[model samples]
Target: MADYVKDIRAKVGHMPLVMVGVGGAYIKDGKVLLQERADTGGWGLPGGYMEYGERVEETLKREFKEDAGLEILSYRFLTNFDQEFFTYPNGDQTQVLTPFYLVTAVKNQPAAFDKHETKAIAFFDFDHLPEIHFASHKKILAYLKTLL
Candidate 1:
């Protein structure tokens, strides 16, 4: 979670806060980047909630770097959708409006988990992806297959 989100959660306490977040599908060699989330232990794209005054692309770039230690070389918007209300294990509730991007990674930076939010990072063939952590991500992967 972002520092500002923590502050907001301190005030709201389990209320469904509407948040805008960004995620990227970093593709190389017929594979896409995925992370095993430390909090959930489920595989998902590298991303997080947007910070105040940041553009969506900025959020994508910052989060991919923070979670996976890789910089995006370029990206194209994939989709924006309203996620169903999600209740975290800690009881925080969020309704996220998230944007997904198809991104290419900058060369020379071997992607690795940041060890804070992500437990592991790897590229997976779409047909062999691990169990996806969230329904929104599942939908995104399905959409990606159509593009392939």
Candidate 2:
């Protein structure tokens, strides 16, 4: 969570809010990269909420580096979905506006991910993906699968 969200939660007290989210869809050798999230203990795309004044691509690159330890070298827009509602285990709810990307990572970056937000990182075949944490992520993956 970002400081801006925390500041708003302080006033709203768990009320639903709207947030812009960006994710990277890193596909290689018929597999998609995913992260095991520390917060939900479920698998999800390695990305995060867009901070105020940041471009969507900037958010995606920053999140990939922070959460997956992969630096995004290039990216192409994949899809956008809105009104995706999610409730945190702690009870915070938000309607997320998401834009996903097909990202290419810089070569030689180690997979030393941020332990605070991610537990592990792996690439899974779309057909054999582990349980996805977010329903929106599942939808995104399904759509991406069709492109293969």
Candidate 3:
């Protein structure tokens, strides 16, 4: 969670707040990158919330670097959806508007990932993807299926 979000939650308690975030499906050799999130222990794409003054693409790039240490070389727009409601493990309630993308990684060597956010990061075959933890990500993958 960003400091700005925390500041807002301080006043709102558990009231649902609208959030905008971005994520990417990074494909390589017919596999997509996934991260096992430390918070949920479920596999999902590399992403995080948009910070103040950040563009949507900047949010995706920054999150992928922070969570997985990978640089996004290029990306194609996938889809955008609004999650009606979600309650985090820590009791934060939010209605998230998320934009999804299909991204290609840069050739630069990646730094070590932030263990606080990701338990593990690896690639998985789309046909045999792990159980997706987030409903929004599942919907994005389902849309990717049509393109494949």
Output the lDDT of residue 31, model 2.
96
Tens-place lDDT per residue, model 2, 31-105, is: 999999998999999888888788888899889988888888888997788969999999999999889899865
Q: Please identify which of the two predictions, 1 or 3, would achieve the higher TM-score against the true structure.
A: 1
- Clash list (residue pairs), candidate 2: none
Q: To one decimal, what is the Cα RMSD in angstroms of model 2 from the true structure?
A: 1.5
TM-score of 2: 0.94
Residue runs of model 1 more than 4 Å from their true location after superposition: none
Pick by TM-score: 1 or 2, better one: 2
lDDT of 1 by residue, 1-148 (tens): 4587889988889888899878888878888888899888899988889988788999998999888888878888988878656788899888899888888546476675578889888889999999998888898888887888
lDDT (C-alpha, whole model) for all candidates? 0.85, 0.88, 0.83
Error of 2 at 103 (Å): 0.3
Listed per candidate, the RMSD to the true structure in angstroms reads: 1.7, 1.5, 1.9
lDDT of 3 at 123: 86
Q: In what order do the candidates fall by lDDT, top score first?
A: 2, 1, 3
Give stretches of model 3 more than 4 Å off: none
